[model samples]
Every structure is written in structure tokens, then in C-alpha cells.
Target: MAWRYRVGLVVAAVALLGAGAAQAYDVAPHRAVYRMALAKAASGSGIATAEGAMALEWGESCEGWTVEQRYRLKLGYTQGGESDVAVSFATYEAKDGSSYRFFIERARPGSMPENISGKAVRGPAGVRAEFEAPEPVKLDLPKDVLFPTQHSLAILGAAEAGQKFLSGMVFDGNEVEEATEITAVIGKQIPAPTEGEELLRRPSWPVRLAFFGPDNAPGGLPDYEMGIRLYDNGIVTEMKLDYGDFVVDATLDKLEKLPKPGC
Candidate 1:
């Protein structure tokens, strides 16, 4: 598979939800409305090889607010030997109990490659896809992309109502292997910085996540450990993937409520 497609699959897998319930968090609700920013760097021999950042915002609507729920992701990466960089964006919204929609876009710096945009629908049976291409073309997704466990995990985390799916499970990728287990880890409250006094600063709680997996089961290596810091409010603020010679870190930043499109 191509690198761009691989990246998109990773993002979709991490952000979408599956059919099972998620593990419960032992935190309070007041601390759930904050935003988290993460910065990740991968380096070797004292030279930085790859760097990326992610930001997440979770909050209720203010007075007279029409929007109910929102989630967005922006990712960029630079490989060690590659000269060109890659960037991608994904955004999702819950319209009601019966329907939701998502948008995805990816681009390389110089080439006019065809951009991807599609929507997924959910109903009584299961989830299905309805996509549109910029031109007359065909697209195929990985096996895991169609049945993503990470996306299901994120949804379970955000809902905080499911706890049965977080137990002993294995996530197998063509090049990556991840195991999910529930463990009690201490969390801390981080204070939000004030910019201008008018902006409200919400308190954020950070919790550590640990598990065992292959260094890069599908694309790169095997036998590695991964750790991530997730805010109590259900946003992954930081992630570190280590496989001896290669390491990747991701951070979140600049989280704001996405504006609703006018009809």
C-alpha cells in the first residue's frame, strides 16, 4: 500500500468506534471539558527524523448553542529520507441518534493528487460507507480500515458508558500488533494557561496508558512498548511509540470548537 493511504487508515482506525463497549474512567465530569495539545518527535544519532502534533477539544455548547458534538484531527509528518512532507485532516459530527457524518482530506506539497472525501452511515444493522471521488476513479481500503478497532475504542472512551471491551484483546495489523488491557494508573490535573482574561480556562486531567505490541507490525518492526497520555475528558494528548532505533511522538495543540456550516 502507499504511504498516504497507510496514514489515512491509521487515523481512521484510531478515531472511529467499533461495536463493543469501552473501559470506564475513574474521574469526574467537571474535568472533562478541557483541551489537550501534544508534540511528538522521532530521532536517532542526535538527529530528528520525524515530528508531528495533534490537538483535541471537548466541551459542551455555550448559551444558545446549536451544535451538540464535534471532533477533528490534523496530522503532518516528515520521513527521514523523504524530501516531501504529508498533511491530512479529518472531522466528524453527530447530527442525531440515527445519523453522523465525517470528512477527510489529504494532500502532498507539490503534486495535484486526487483528494479523498467520504461519509459513513450507521443504522440498526451496522455501519456502511458512501463515498465521492474528485474524478472518475476507484479506491480500496485495508481490511482493518473497514473493521477498525481503534476508532471503536475512541468512541467507547468518549461515551464513557462502556467498559467491557477494554479487557484482554489483541489488535493485529499486517505490520503492527497491539494488545489492550485495563490497568489502574495515577492521573494529574494540569492547569490551562490564560491568554487574555476573557477566555475560560478549563482544568485538564492526564492519565497514562501502557500496553505491549510490535514495533511496526504492518510497516516497520516487532516487540515494542507504547505509552500514551490521555486526558480524563477522553482526548489523547500525547503518544510515544518505541522500537529501539525508531521512535515516534505525537502532541495535540490549537483546539477550538469547529464552526457549524450554515444551511
Candidate 2:
């Protein structure tokens, strides 16, 4: 359920920023591949061992920024057989964070594939999300909220300012209901990432986020937590996904810079 953390990160990492914006990190278009493995599983979770791979490509189009993400996880069970979980998602987010359109699908063993498609626009009141696939429903966004890319940039800015704790509301269209309550703790800035490739070794910070729903939150335990080794340019070199019952670690295996449109 907290897997929305990963989904939001993918959306946040796949966007364009117009020039001359005051931001702590410059956004870029790139592709990243990660090797993933289950780090831990609580008892009775029915998980024996799991391995997966993820690939995400963020590129700019004439109309907006485009994102493509694919993930596959093979899980061997303690009781019996094995199952593969697959998810594919793509979206377009406007440079100004005023709107977003997304398409997502999830498939698993012995189950019908689930699909969601929608668009959202920000107005004076707040964001209004409209869903077309699965069903038609409208969801309300909170006030003073940030979209995916804006949320990422805000976190980076706070980290750069040496602020250790930050809180905000973020809407990534990962959920069909409401926005997520985000609380982040930023660690000291590191001059280099020891295990990262050349392009990833730049100044960065360690960030962790606890995500929750709006109701009874801050008092309620987070549904999930995510830790990231985030570079100044919105690239995450390493990540830990904590799903309450289980945890998974992701390592960036390949990184490639994509060509940007000439100014």
C-alpha cells in the first residue's frame, strides 16, 4: 500500500523545469535501472524471497515531460509456489506543476489486471482529480499542496538549507482517494556517493519520508517509509522501501543522460 512512495518518486523524477526557477537542484532528463531485492520480511508475511528489477526513463516531449516505468518482482512463497508481480506506469506532468495525466496498470498471479487512468488540474480551490478508467470519480486535494516534482524540489531545497525536518502534502495521482501526508528527515550533506557512478557522486543528501493518509495522521503510524540517497539533480542513487511488513533495497545499476532540447 505504501508502495505509493515508489510510484510518487517515479513521477517526481520524471518532469521538466522551466529555466530561471529558484531551485536547490537542477532537474534533468535521464534513465535509471535498478537491481532490487527483499531485505527483510516479517513472519507470516508469506514471503520467502523476492528479487526484482526496475527501469525508469524520463524524457522531455514537445508538449510536456514524459515518464515510463516498469517493475517486475518474483516472489517465492514459504508455503508453496511462486508469483510474479508486474507494474507499468507512464505520465505527463506539466512544467509548472499545474496539471498531470497518468496511466497505470498492475498485474499479479490469479488476479485480474487493475488499471487506472486520470487527469488532474489545479485551481484556486485546490487540485481536482478526475478518473476515467476503472470508474469515474473526483478527488479533492489539500491546500498548500505540492505536485510530484514540486515536492521533490521542496525536499531538496530544505536539505540544502540544512533543515533536518520538513512536512508537506503531495499529490502524485498514485492513490484514487486523497493526497499523502509527507514528513521527511534530512541527513547531513555528503560530498560524494561512495558507491555511485561518476555522474552520481556529486553532492547529495540522505532523506527519509514517512507517508500517511490525511485522516488521523501524524498521530497515526505511517503506512510506509522510504529512504533515499538523493543527488542534487533529482537523481536517487540508492533507495530503501519499507512497507511496514517487509523491506526492499534498491541499488542503481545503470544511469544514462538523455539529450535535452536546445534552448
Candidate 3:
């Protein structure tokens, strides 16, 4: 799920240089609330029911973009048990994608909270990262790796260009070990639905993102896959997370614009 959270975006409308389109593609800063529930579950999956809520606050700063995400999920098991899971995640990514800091905490019944905090810097040599929590360790990544925001921008650019496929390795602070390989399938552009709020009444695309683990071979089954109705303005109105045995659906329940930084 680390890769899932990394898709979160922040900051005001930053221009996409070399995106090769006349239309302005700006990412809006806002707080989005989503209601989550089980869309489907395979038999013998043991998952009886699932429901939850997620709140994501994305804002901008003078030097970078910031995000705070809270997720709470209640799962009912067929064997007569329930588990409540909560996750708190925060991140700060430099405007140039040169630096990133992240903190994540996850808690569940009868288990101690697990916390991961770290920072990474991308330079000409490559990406060097240091973790200060749960343990002390260092890592280095390939120079060609893309950060989270950079990955988002690349997807937007590809969609605008009518490119149906894009793939890359993305490093978000969530997976301290290594970057995750991502393959994106961009679908045809869709006109905005007339039933949503004003902010959602914009053109969008059906984008499917497949996340593969480091050891997965080419064309192997992805560790996780998500489908999103991604708008041109960088807003996601709907999402479906597929976990093989079960699928969770997220629908946008509320949206609030965040004030942009003076810088």
C-alpha cells in the first residue's frame, strides 16, 4: 500500500514544461475526503465486509509540496472477527524533486504502532536515503528513478499526449527499501459528468496503474493495481484498488480548495 499513498499530490497549478500541449495543466491544492467500501471479494478470501474513510490534505509551501493522509479501515472476517486498521502518513517533497521527507505510522489491534521516517536526496550521482526510525540504515538508488510527484507529472503528460502506455520506477519514502516499478495504461479522454460538483466537471481519463515489486519479471502479475478517473486538472474523482483477493472502491465525498502559497 505504500505505492498507493505515494500517488497523492499537492501544490498549486505548476506548469508542466515540455508537456507539449497548449492547454494549461495545473494540479490543484485541496483536501479530499473519500468513503471506502468493499467492492468485491473472492470466495474463501475470509473478508466479510469492509468499510472506511480516508482524508487527504494536500498543500503547497515555498520550497515544496506537502501532504497529510489519514486512513481508517474496519474489516469484518467471516470467521467471526474484526480488525480496525489506521494509518497516518505525511510527506514533504521538494519542488524540484531533489529531496523528500516522509513519516508513516500504522496501527492495528494487539500490535504496536509501526513507524517509518526517512529522507532522501537525489543528485547527479543518484539517490541517497537515510532512515532515522525503526532502525538506522542508508540506501542508494539509480539515477533514472523518478520521485512521486515527478511520476504524477509524467502520467499527466503522457495522457495529454494521447500516449496509452507509460512505465517507470518511482521512489516514494514509503518503501524505504527500493523503488517500485509502475506501468500505467491511459484510456481515452472522457467528458466530465454533469452530476458532480463544479470542481469535478472537467475532462478526465480512465487511468489504470499497475505496481510491481522489485523481483517481479516483465509481464508478471502486479503486486497491486489501481484504477482511477483522473482529471486533466490532476484531481481523482474515483479509485478502485485491486488486491487480488478483494477490491476496495473509493469515491470522492468532499473536496475543499486549499489556499496557495504566495511564492
Best by TM-score: 3
Per-residue alpha-carbon lDDT of candidate 3 for residues 14-123, written as tens digits (9 for 90 to 100): 12322232123467777899899999988988889989988888776766778788888888989998888888889887777678898988888899998999998988
For model 2, the local distance difference test gives 0.74
Error of 1 at 72 (Å): 15
Runs of candidate 1 with Cα error greater than 4 angstroms are: 1-48, 55-81, 95-97, 134-226, 241-245, 252-263
TM-score of 3: 0.89
**What are the runs in model 2 whose C-alpha is more than 4 Å off?**
1-6, 10-24, 61-63, 193-196, 214-218
- The Cα error of candidate 1 at residue 183, in Å, is 14
* All candidates in order of TM-score, best leading: 3, 2, 1
Model 3 residue 106 CA deviation (Å) reads 0.4
lDDT (Cα, tens digit) per residue for candidate 1, span 1-263: 01212222221113333322222332111211222222333342332344433323222221111112222323333433433333343434342222223343444557774354454444556444444544332223222232222443443353343332232222322221222222223344456546632222434433333332324344333344334554333444455544344445554443443432332
Each model's lDDT: 0.33, 0.74, 0.75
TM for candidate 2 is: 0.87
lDDT per residue for candidate 2 within 122-203, as digits (tens), equals 7878889898888998988755666666677777777777889988777766657677778888899998657746677678
Better of 2 and 3 by TM-score: 3
**lDDT (C-alpha) at residue 31 in model 1:** 17
Q: Give the Cα RMSD of candidate 1.
A: 9.3
RMSD after CA superposition, every candidate: 9.3, 3.3, 3.8
Better of 2 and 3 by lDDT: 3
